[model samples]
Target: MSIWGRVFAAGYDRIMEGAEKSVLRAHRQALVGRASGRVLEIGGGTGANLPFYGDDVAELVITEPEEPMARRLEDKLAASARTAEVVRAPAEDLPFVDASFDVVVSTLVLCTVGDPAKSLTEIRRLLKPDGRLLFLEHVRSDDPGLARWQDRLHGIQVRIGHGCHCNRDTLASIESAGFTVSELRHDQLLKAPPIVRPLVIGIAQAKA
Candidate 1:
């Protein structure tokens, strides 16, 4: 990461902390019954999901690349009742064996991966044949005008947000990786200021 990249990530995380926590808190209850067994969460920044997870999960492993963010997650984990493990790594190239996890989760992470397709492929590989991949992501708008604006601002956004893109069609990417969708829901996260895009969330099962 560049010097400016680090600065941008720091500022971005700090600014979005409250909104993210709020959003996660609301959506997390839905995640409780799904995440189970050996779960691997990609881009689990600051261990925000710790509070939401239930006792059903046997183990929780987080892969977070940002060093500063990982430290913050350590602090969060210190207070968490769940026994969690943190890996300072990126989603694109995960360091784990094939079919290693029973559940894989990614929240607002696909938009920033170096290669979203490749990362999803890796996630698929890491998951057991019958494992599930659950995700919450912001995606490209269907509106022509809004999409154009997203395309235009995406360049600048990626620079300041450590490659985070607001226009990725993450659902399509997951489907392209050969996963079978089990359930899905979409909602608008920002209804006032940036009211154009919607949050795309889904739970998919790896084909057996």
Candidate 2:
């Protein structure tokens, strides 16, 4: 990680403390609680989702590209009940065999990946034939006014928020990557900024 990257990651937990307490903690638990079998989690930021995986999960592997963030995640995982191997790698290029993981997880990460499409493709490649993807992401809103604002502020958000884009049509990106969305729910974060509050939570399966 660069100096700026380290700087952003150093304060990441403190910055998100409020959101975690108010809304994200519960949401992450609910989403990660359902994972089963051999699992892979993309962008395990500060290991916030680490405490939520249930015993049904046989093995857990977490990937984080940024060194500073990965280091923090390792620290959190050290104290977690559920053990997980931390891999320093980008989502766009996973170092695993094809059809290896039963479940792939991405929470609040797609928006920040350098290439969401490539990342999803790699995720699909790593999944078993019957594997499913579990995700909780903030996406472009249906409301035109809010979406416009998201678009206008997206560049600035990326610059400051570690490459997060507030206006991506994530559902469309998922579909384009050939994942058949099986279950989807929409909601807003309890106390998040409007640009990033529109949330999409769901399960998606690799297209047969």
The prediction achieving the highest TM-score against the true structure is: 2
Clashing pairs in 1: none
TM-score of each: 0.91, 0.97
List the candidate 1 regions with Cα displacement exceeding 4 Å: 8-13, 191-196
Per-residue alpha-carbon lDDT of candidate 1 for residues 34-56, written as tens digits (9 for 90 to 100): 78899999998766677877777
Q: Please list the Cα RMSD from the true structure of every candidate, rounded to 1 decimal place.
A: 2.1, 1.0
Q: Candidate 2 at 67: error in angstroms? A: 0.3
Instruction: Report the lDDT tens digits of candidate 2 across residue range 150-169.
Output: 99999899888879999999
RMSD of 2: 1.0
Residue 90 of model 2, lDDT score: 92
Question: Each candidate's lDDT (Cα)?
Answer: 0.81, 0.92
